[model samples]
Target: MARRPKLFEAAPGSPAETRCQLCERAVRHTSRHHLVPREEGGRYGPTVDLCQPCHSSVHLLLTNKELARRYHTVEDLQRAEELQKYLHWIRRSRVERITNRRRRR
Candidate 1:
């Protein structure tokens, strides 16, 4: 049997161009962060790269009782279209921030 390739290797090229989904910072040492908890059948497809700080922040959000309470099951997270929308929104926002920073330089 063959070992599975690392996500970065599987999707080769430069991650710096990929952009962090949370802060829109250049993704250095990028790692896939699942928007929905993986335990709830959230696979890699629903993943996005996030910088360390943003990644930590995401986990923090999940830790919140209110959010956790709202999402009682993996189906709840998956079925909630707003969650997907929010992920896209965060990615776009980050991209905008990155573009703005580039303009400032």
Candidate 2:
């Protein structure tokens, strides 16, 4: 099977840091999330730079079809009840990056 290309790749000498559009935090690495997924015939629309945790939470909480149908914007995503809860809790996190490791609390 062919490997999928990365969603967003930095230019040769682009800035190293970028702000996460969701939680308003600084992140060294970001993932690109399409508001309308390619599978849903959404080619061009809004996309956001999200930190790993935010990106994971989105997929965990909503289906791609749901994202394309209802939450197709950053504001829409922020308004999601589950996403709001995650964002609220994440706000107090001192860690810059959130990984797949399960937290004790």
What C-alpha lDDT do the candidate models reach, one value each? 0.48, 0.76
lDDT per residue as tens, model 2, 1-105 = 997443443444468757789887666677888989878867776689988888888887787889899988899988988688889987666445556744333
Q: Supply candidate 2's per-residue lDDT for 23.
A: 80
Instruction: Output the TM-score of candidate 2.
Output: 0.72
Task: Tell me the RMSD of model 2 versus the true structure.
Answer: 8.2
Best by TM-score: 2
- Model 1 earns a TM-score of 0.41
Candidate 1 lDDT, 16-53, residue by residue in tens: 45555555545445577665556555555356666554
Off by over 4 Å in 1: 1-18, 64-105
Alpha-carbon runs more than 4 Å astray in model 2: 1-15, 96-105
lDDT of 2: 0.76
lDDT of 2 at 80: 86
